[model samples]
Target chain A: MSYLKEFTKGLVKENPTLVTLLGMCPTLAITTMASNAIGMGAAATFVLICSNVAISLLKKFIPKQVRLPSYIVVIAGFVTLISLILQAFVPAVYDALGIYLPLITVNCIILGRAEMFASKNNVAASALDGAGMGIGFTLALLAVGSIREILGSGTWFGLPLIPEAAQEAIKPMTIFVLPAGGFFVLGCVIALVNKIANRKPPEATGCAACPNRESCISVEKAESTVENTKKEENK
Target chain B: MNKLFVESSPHIRSAWTTQKIMLNVIIALCPALVMSTYIFGIKALLLTVICCTSCVLFEFAFNKITKREDTISDLSAVVTGMLLAFNLPVDLPVYMAIIGCFVAIVIVKCLFGGIGQNFANPAITARIVLMMSFAGAMTKWTAPFAWKEGVDATVSATPLAAETLPSMTDMFLGFRAGCLGETCIAALLLGGLYLMFIGLIRPATPLCFIGTVAVLSFFYGGCDVNFMLYQLMSGGLILGAFFMATDYATTPLTTKGKIIFGVGCGLITFAIRQYASMPEGVSFSILVMNCLTPLIDRFTAPKALGTVKPKKEGKQ
Candidate 1:
């Protein structure tokens, strides 16, 4: 595949959060605020790109049986590096992220891309995939974070959007910041994203109607019906 | 030529259609509606109208957009709207109540394939959502008759919060603070009687439900009859037992399952009232039990009468 395709796929077609659904622990936990989301996203992206590059470079030398352990060691090194940097320079975000920052070592997004994409791909392709996926993850976080912050806190980035005089009249829905709110918002976001990406409605029914129907199964039936009609017209 | 109608099931059916059933429920809710207006003033009536209209409108709009047949004619939306409004405080902002109606008709009902298809009671789930999303507004109950004397109706406390418990007669007469429809046990009971008379709901679920709660509270209160009556009268227990816990789609079909469901609801309600921080727990308890209807039905399904039990392995 072209480098552009490799890079661009993760942005939407293969998004880490909304599409692939990796790294949900931090996605749901730390995306309560826009600033926290950005901080966490950027930190995770940094770790992702570095780990992908490291894993790709060492793929030939690393033993096949213990590749998971080696991959974790490499990912952990980058995570610790990121953790120290964030703690030193951005102590506020460090404190806000708390245990989640170090917990990034186990974030499936980083390890997933490292194993699935970087282990087999060339260095440049792996780097581009990492960047694509990182940007995708960051964008997903930003989307969820903005929604939660605006509705739950009446702020976009810790700045009040509703006027102070009107604040008492229009109290924000405080549930969006809580765990249940996070789930509702996440579910809605995923639904919206899926709707946009898959423009064609599933054949003969809605999602709720036939829980057993697979997407491509419907597509296959539709395509074969069309081909049969075309052959009849020719005859 | 003679006409023939082919259908599934036992073939023989009652005259009752979905629309008729829903219309009966709407009629059954009238006593409580009148009582709420009497206690809370004309604002209660206005809120009910707004909620019911918005619910039907939302259902119509959703069906139009989704290209499905309009189900508003069936009157389930109206029933859901009335039930949702009944659980709310009379002083709730109209827009907030409308929002709750939207959650009920659109999210809970329509999204789950509309009437007869939802997994839980739409009104119960919508009330829970509104409770969680807008706790302060949702819980702002004013003193009964406060609206009558033009006394500032901003006082916020239910019967559970009052320093001195209101007299049982006062609570029964809807003179105490509670949800719009729940404060009036007399009205809810009247409605319940009307429903039972019309055969809209069976006595199994409601009777067993209130009975379990009464017995448990009596024992828990050290065999105090007043405490038992107080527990039964307060909260939305009567309203839930009569209207919500008996929802056709959310409750079980078999008699045995309905009894099991009622016992489960009663136990959960007592536990939540006694242990949870929230003063009242009717809607929560009903919603929780609604989640278990399928399981309860499965376990309580009646076996075939003629089927023989299996013999012991050694005997076989």
Candidate 2:
């Protein structure tokens, strides 16, 4: 049940793309088409899961100072493997994904999970976390891609949805396939997710999850000390 | 018995509330609206009506769904709709116009915390989005008064995109093919003059914006006055400078900031018109400058009274 929770959490509550906003380059670039989104998502997931497991297994062997470089080595190997497999069989998707497929080695979700989860957890839990995160990223990409595709191109997965006559009356907004449309759709999707989840903004939730919490607290303390000295002098 | 009143600062009351200001803006827009209707015929009026109605409806609906205070009474949405309609081609499909309204009122305005809080002018942004989305439809300008021939509207290029320009009088009177409200120099100037007269908008931004464009185009056209005037009169320059660029929310606050913002807009517009593929750049330039308004305001902020300037370390 705990493992399942780890997998389920990434789908909505801890979505890397929609919630945490990780790996935005691929999320914004390759999501013009639903097929490209799935291809990139699947490729990233493979790399993520493999790297997570491998990093978790080798965590004990790696020195703490050089763990990030060691993790990159693991991730690069998996990314290359996936790239070769896709190139060998699904050449069309390989071409469509192009540079983004190989670029997955440095995707923040994979590295983030590797650093934040795999290094600290056992292999099974790390693999589950990777899977959940990878799936979440894919689902978010898919949602954005589908919206852009349907509205921008008047099609779903290259199948014509708008009739020929209707197409003349109202041409599909080609901007949806453009980079601007990708941003618009992504923003709207994130807003929708936030609405559905009733999530508080990061500020309202406080500094517990903030990466800069310690530094921020120290700064606040320093400011208060200065203010205290000033008040004493004034008195 | 005498009545005594106690109050805080700002004891002076004025008749110019938000609704009254918006109403004044609508009244100012009437000249251009009337000119567009005269030039483009009934379709222009119909598009304006549809855009205004849809914009108000979208704002009302969005407010209801978000359970925020009712803001439709301010009439800002109607202004946005009218401005968006003015930006659009007269012959654009009704659905596309409605989509633009949705973008203006719902996405750009309400989603960003409503009217005064919007980062950019909703009408301008929506027009740009519509231009990008429906490029073919957005650019397909119909010749002025083509409907009066009792046949289908003949497609024609706007003055900016045309091979040979129309006579100055024709262009000035708005007998040229262009976006709904942009062709008429006379009507737009009339509206701009009214806004300035009523003190609804300061003259600094619009004057600087138009002046910059005029100066740049003059030099770029090899100091030809006719060419400079044509450049100034063409496209959405006058309409944008007076109405959209001077938007109170998106533009800078201080006089110095407004001047910088206006000059920035003019430079971008000049660059895009001279070098870029797009024939017109008023909307794009204004949008870019709108994003820089906060920075301009920050840099141009006035020092409060009695505040000493920081001493230079090296000089000290």
Candidate 3:
């Protein structure tokens, strides 16, 4: 596949976060902060790119029987290398990434692509795929992180979004930053995006045939007043 | 021929209809509702009625505008109303109960694809939402009538309050003021037992969950063991374990998985109550376990009898 295809595929079709549902642990955990997103994204991207290329090179030498352990050793090597470099140079990203950096060896996205794509593909194709995928994963992490940071922490990339006085007035949605909040937001995003992409008429089950339609006067009262007319007719 | 109406997914249909189950649930919460009003005074009764009415109205309006299938006839709106009332204080401002109703029946319940499809317990989520929005009102526990009004209007602590712990007996008897359905043990148990009798819920989740909590409390809970019993009886445990945690869409179907679900709920509930800063743990624990239901179901699949013991072909 062309390099552009390699990159764009990861962004949408093979998206590690949404489409493939890989690397969910970090995707769900670190996305709580934009800074964490950027940092975690970059770290995972670096590990992914390196791991993919190395795995592609080693694909032939490793026997089919022990290919999993084979891939792990190579991935572990890259993860360790990144961990050392982060600690030596940028200690903060290292500290922030915490044990998660080491745990990257287990991230399903990395191992999945290595097993499914890179190990079978040429070295050049594997590298391009890695960069494409790394960027895609980074984008997802950043997106998820930005949402959480703004809503949960009352900040974006650590900047205060709410005014200082208003901050005290309005309680930050503490749930947004929490683990369950991560699941809720991700679920909503999935449900909403699926609705748009599928373009099926919205599945209806609530107020249309309802007996209390006259009393139920709220925004969900719907656009097509035909529903109201019919509700009244039924009444 | 393309059909004009189509029932959606999980194509498997049980004998139970949504409306019947919901009616059963409302019945389950009724004892609590009645007992709370009797203990807390006419305010609790009025608050519950207001919440129930507003919830039904909100569901109606949401349906009218959305042009979806009318859901109020199913009594889901009623269940939401009753659950909301159950979660709230009798002393709460009427409009706040309306807001709670709106959040329960509208935002949390409807927005997430209505009724069974909602990710969390709508009442609990709404309660939490209200807790955030009106923390003061949510926590303002009124003392019982004490047979005089102005004499003892003091804002004494809830039974959960350590310094002013109601006698375990009083808490069991529903004499103190708390959330509408949560203050009374006998009422909640009666409601739970009624639900069990109706078969809206399996006994395993509530029984195992409560059982686990009792044993763990004996070993780990710092409070008196009987206090743990009172704690289990007092708050939203009955409502959550029987009604919310066992929500069909959110919980596992198999018997063993339900047990594991109950155990997980129990452990998390106990952990939160014992270790966390919060006074209650039922809602958080149920929601957390709700998230894990899919994974639990995946693991606890009942082994097919034939698969476990493959019959020998002609040779046998």
Candidate 4:
């Protein structure tokens, strides 16, 4: 039950791509085509699972001060391995993914999992977490990629969905293949996911979790000073 | 028998309600609307009606679904629809125009908290989206009055994209191929002047925007006044400068900021037009500047009457 929970949580509750929003570079870049999305997802997932298990196994030996760099080296090694494998076997996807394939070395999802989950957890749990998160990221990419491909190219997985005659009448919007369309689709997908999950805005729990905590805290301080002056005047 | 009503500041109110302002904008747009109809025939008028109706319906539906207050009565959506129609090629399919309307009212406006809260001008953004989606259809311009040829209207490049330029008088009087609303300089100026007269929009942004383009094109064309005039009248420059660039919600508030925004728009437009593959850069430039409006407002915000800047202790 504990192992299953760790695996299932990443599919939805703690989805790295949709919820935590890690690995955005590839999510927005390689999702122009459904096939590219799957290829990229598989590559990233392989790296993620491998790196997670390796990090979890080696965590006791790695010093806390140098853990992050050590994790990067491990992740980079797996990323290179996957990149070479893809380049040798599936050159089409390799060419399509381009620089983004190598860029998986710096993907925040792998490092985030290593630091937050793998580094602290046992090998089994960390591997489960990695597999779950990897699958979640893949699913998210597939959703975004399918939408972009269908609308942008009037096709899915390179098979012509819209008939030729109809395509002439209602040509596919090429913009969906562009970077701007990636953002629009990503936003819509995220919104849909939030709605499906009935996700409410995260409750403010001090400044730690807030992204804009630095600027927000300063504003709060200024506001409090103004309020203090007002109270003094009233007194 | 005097009743005292206590409220915050801005105690004074004006008769310029959202509806009234929208109505005035609609009225100002009438000349260009009329010109497009005349140039493109009944198809232009049909497209406009479809766009306006769909925009209003989309907004109404979105509000109903979200359980928000009905905003359709404000007629802002109507203005957005009309502006969108104006930006489209007259020969575009009705369904595409409706998609543009959905993007304008729903995606760009309602999703961002509706009306006054949208980061970019809804019409401008929707037009760009449509342009990107249907590049072939969007760029397929019909020559003025070519609809008279019955369905097989002679397709022609817009003045900016043409190999040889049309006469200044022809371009000024709106005898050319371009988007429905962008062709006619005369009608657009009439609408712009009316908006300025009604005090709904200040001339600072439009003047600075057009002037910057004029100055840049003059030098770029090696001091040729004719080329400058041609550049000013061509594409969506006049239409965008007078109307979309002056959108209150997406534009800067202060005069200094408005000038900066306008000049920024002009610079981008000029660069794209002169160097870029695309002939028209008005929409892209306006969209870019619209995104920068918040920053412009922040930097140009008026200081409080009695507030003093904090002194740097170490420097002193």
Give per-residue lDDT, candidate 4, residue B134.
93
- Cα lDDT tens digits, model 4, A1-235, are 4999889877887788887788999999999899988999999999999999999999999998898899999999998999899889989988999999999989998888887778878999989989999999999999999999999998999999987778768888899999999998998999888899898787865444433233233457766888999999999
Instruction: Judge candidate 4 at residue B104 and give its lDDT.
Output: 96
Q: What shift in Å separates residue A144 of candidate 2 from its native position after superposition?
A: 1.0
What tens digits encode model 4's per-residue C-alpha lDDT throughout B165-260? 889898998989999999899999999999999899999999999999999999999999999999999999999999999998899988999999
Better of 2 and 4 by DockQ: 4
* Ranking 3 against 4 by lDDT, winner: 4
Q: What is the per-residue lDDT of model 1 for residues A1-235, given as tens digits with 9 covering 90 to 100?
A: 7999889988998898997788999999988999999999999999999999999999999998898899999999998999999889989999999999899999998888887789888899999989999999999999999999998889998999999898767878777899878988898999999899973544656533432223224555766888999999999
Ranking by lDDT: 4, 2, 1, 3
Model 3, span B1-21: residue lDDT tens: 567844533466888877877
- lDDT assessment of candidate 1: 0.87
Off by over 4 Å in 2: A202-207, A210-235, B1-13, B310-316
Please give the C-alpha DockQ score of model 1: 0.48
Q: Which ten residues in a row have the lowest lDDT in candidate 4 chain A?
A: A208-217
**Residue pairs with backbone overlap in model 3:** A31-A145, A207-B63, A209-B70, A210-B70, A216-B61, A220-B65, A221-B65, A222-B65
Instruction: Evaluate all candidate structures by whole-model CA lDDT and list the values in order.
Output: 0.87, 0.90, 0.77, 0.91
Off by over 4 Å in 1: A199-235, B1-12, B304-316
Q: What TM-score would each prediction reach against the true structure? A: 0.89, 0.91, 0.65, 0.91
